[model samples]
Target: MSETSSSVLTRMGAAFGSMPPALWRLLLVLAVFLVGGIAGWIGRGVLAGPADVPTMSVYEDWHLLCPALKTKDGACEISQDVYEQRAGERLARIILAKEKDKSMVMYVTVPLQVLLEPGIGLKLGNDQVRVYQYKTCTEEGCLAVIPVDDQLLASLTKAQDAGIDVAQPNGKAAELPFSMKGYADAYGAFLNNEAKRKSWWRRLWS
Candidate 1:
């Protein structure tokens, strides 16, 4: 080739070499992320939807869900207020279904999950899904409080020597208590308690 053509080609090569390596790496990273996101969407079949999933009320650790204070974008502040209000000095959670039939009010005292497991054993109903873990506290003693993947099922399974009247679910979340109407009536004969009204502040927190 002629001298001028050789020099022009050399200048073009020099310009390409002078370009920042970081820019190339950044473009490569962007391409990889786009590919990964596409793959995940295809695998999960999640298309153009809200990514944020709300937690269930039954997972009773209110502290983590509580929002930050004195800052922008703090959603948990409302949750914090509500929990502080509903929560009692002593709290107990009831695992039960609400039904129109008075005889169907099947319920159990939610124990710590750590106490539930396999051959360890618990006498809950077959159709009974973990509906709730009601928190209860008295002046002297309290039930163990834990987060997700931990609840009454754990504790009950370990200690076969438990005293709760274990009953099987009657194939429905609501009807599971149908057979035990009279039994439930006679069991807790003492705590015929009246519901108390909560204050405005409690309502706000709640």
Candidate 2:
């Protein structure tokens, strides 16, 4: 047979034009299947890939409440100035919270890779608190519960940020920043709550 050649599109169009209706339908169906298979493969590859890490926030769960925000009817209006971030897959968190006795406590939870002997160091402005002993450690991480006195509390409230310092076994140091966004307000609220609880207990017993 003599060879007959043309441009790719023209040759394809001619072949398709000369093809029987049934054969043309079969080719169309095969083309659709091929395209669909390629699309599905791409989708699966995208879905199975590693997910993107999220951006972490500095102030995570910092809130303040004070009696000054209370109304005249003996009901204190609570402010919802909350700043909190989810640790999720992240390593460490420095938490400042209040106890039942109105005392402030600082707790640091770090990854299991950290050394627990020297304790966790904390610094607020010019003041520094030495390594608070490690309380416990688990698969998640280690915990250091530091005692915060009135003087330290005052410094923390006035300072913009605090630092959690850790000394590695190799004598190197790692520092993490703790945001002081809503410290004063939260401390005020904690004191008010403690006072209210004490007043109620005294009235019940007396």
Highest-scoring model, TM-score:
2
Candidate 1 local lDDT, residue 32: 100
State each model's CA lDDT, in order: 0.33, 0.62
The per-candidate count of clashes, in order, stands at 31, 8
Please identify model 1 stretches exceeding 4 Å from their true place: 1-18, 46-95, 98-206
TM-score of each: 0.21, 0.50
- Give a tens-digit lDDT track for model 2, residues 1-206: 33555576678998889999999899999999999999988986776533322212222345433232222222222222212246435556656565556456776777777777777887787776566888998885788877788777678779876667776767687876666766676556656654654575534522
In model 2, residue pairs whose N, Cα or C atoms come closer than 3 Å (at least 3 residues apart or on different chains), thus clashing, are 60-84, 60-85, 61-83, 61-84, 64-185, 64-186, 65-185, 65-189
lDDT, candidate 2, at 151: 76
Instruction: Write one digit per residue (lDDT tens) for candidate 1, span 1-206.
Output: 99999999999999877879998788789999999988977975655333334322312222122222222222221011111134432222323322333222323333232222210112344423333332443443223222223244343223323223222233221111212222232222211210111234323433
**What clash count does candidate 2 reach?**
8
